[model samples]
Target: MSYNLLTSIDNNRLKQLKNFKTIILNGNNFTSFPSILYQFETLHINENPLCLAPPNDFINDKYISATSNLYVQINDKYEEKLFEIYQQIFIENLTSYDIENLSTRFKLSKTDMNDFREKYSHLKRENKIEILLNIWKQKRGSLANSDALYKFAQLIGDKNLVQKMQKTYLLARKIRI
Candidate 1:
């Protein structure tokens, strides 16, 4: 619906809607792109707070409307680079306890933080770290750059971890250049 408060849609049930080729989800509170929307012939998802990047399969602009006004989409290569750097940092120098510390410093919304704790807290440390970074990047977009990682490390007051982050990032930059 165009003006309903639908935060999410049931893909299975929605798919069963006979003769409905398009779905208009404007003015909803969807923070993440509903993956199932791609199955529709047309989608109107503007006016929603869709921060997370759409799936790679949803690149066909013909079926979807403008969502750029609501969130900045980072280049896929850049997103991969950021994830690689953070993954290295987390794998080498951080533990679950350290991740917990970092999560507190993320300044994420209470609902987001709670969702992480409820749904993702029991995941393996590495996966948990990845999910945390993904959440941060989606919520903050360009603001969730290397500087934010450095600040999170600094907040933990682990000099060794901070040094490792700096060294790792510098090495990554050197390789890119």
Candidate 2:
């Protein structure tokens, strides 16, 4: 499956494709090479090893030549900006109740909302916000850019936070340009 558009894969699924001569996991967010893929004759994960540290074990492995290199930096700057916006909101003296309210503003699906709450219940308010933002980012995919973040602040009806985030977003854009 060269380009099945998979964002993630699991060990069980890899087992099913074990007999294939070549496997490509290009363009996904793998922090390290999947161990199950080591036996394949040709393995490709061109855009992966997204985490700061690159996997070094298979650097000399003959069958896995393509994945031998390392990523110098994380690629998704948009996701980083979204997290920064949420961090600003959480740090602006928002009360616990207000932070809890903002969590629901993402308009996540019913299942996602419930799953998010249950999974992140033990985290601090700030961590919970970060987790919520991650879920929203995953749900929105490429659409979760600065503009969508601005709209989310508007939806929260916090004019001051909206203005601050807007300014930061614009400054980031200018710097990037």
Candidate 3:
């Protein structure tokens, strides 16, 4: 195939490779990828420095867009699906098992998984109890426990909190009736 990272190709070679189909460049020497790379059908650029940027030189006639266009589409789909997974776990009030399971399932490094968990923490048992108490205070005519919150309580296995929640719920139901 073609190589560009850590490899210096002279202008003469670059000119000869205009018809070349695939090349992987790392922008190791340059602040941005060379315009010569725009000619390829498939391109891969990895380990780019913070200063390295894509050369905004997509040619309509010669450049086929297999690299940039495909990368954007794939990145977008991956991010969307990832967001959905995070939301699902957060709403479920993620259990210790879910945390371990999701990280393993995604093959994420522990550090990466920790960062993700920090962003999407589930409500603590106390927080759920507080919310339930608030609903009782508001007397909103209905006292339906949110499924995620309840499920999370079940998974958390705090018998005291569960009993407290049960008592609170009966009290709220009595008030409503």
Report each candidate's C-alpha RMSD, comma-separated, in the order given. Answer: 13.9, 13.8, 19.2
- Pairs in clash, predicted candidate 1: none
Candidate No. with top lDDT: 1
> Candidate 1 residues 54-112, lDDT tens each?
65456555534544432343233444565567657855676535666667777678898
Query: After best superposition, candidate 1 residue 128: deviation in angstroms?
Result: 1.8
Question: What is candidate 3's lDDT per residue for 1-177, written digit by digit as tens?
Answer: 233445344667778887778877644433345667666776666533322235566534444465456445544443343333333334344333344553453344566556545654686643443333333324422232243334444556656545554554455334323
Question: lDDT of candidate 3?
Answer: 0.46
Error of 3 at 2 (Å): 8.8
Winner on lDDT (2 vs 3): 2
What is candidate 1's local distance difference test score?
Answer: 0.67
- Indicate the TM-score of model 3: 0.29
Ranking by TM-score: 1, 2, 3
Report model 2's TM-score to 2 decimal places: 0.46
Q: Least accurate stretch of 10 residues (summed lDDT) in model 3?
A: 136-145
> Candidate 2 deviates by what RMSD?
13.8
Candidate lDDT (C-alpha), each = 0.67, 0.62, 0.46
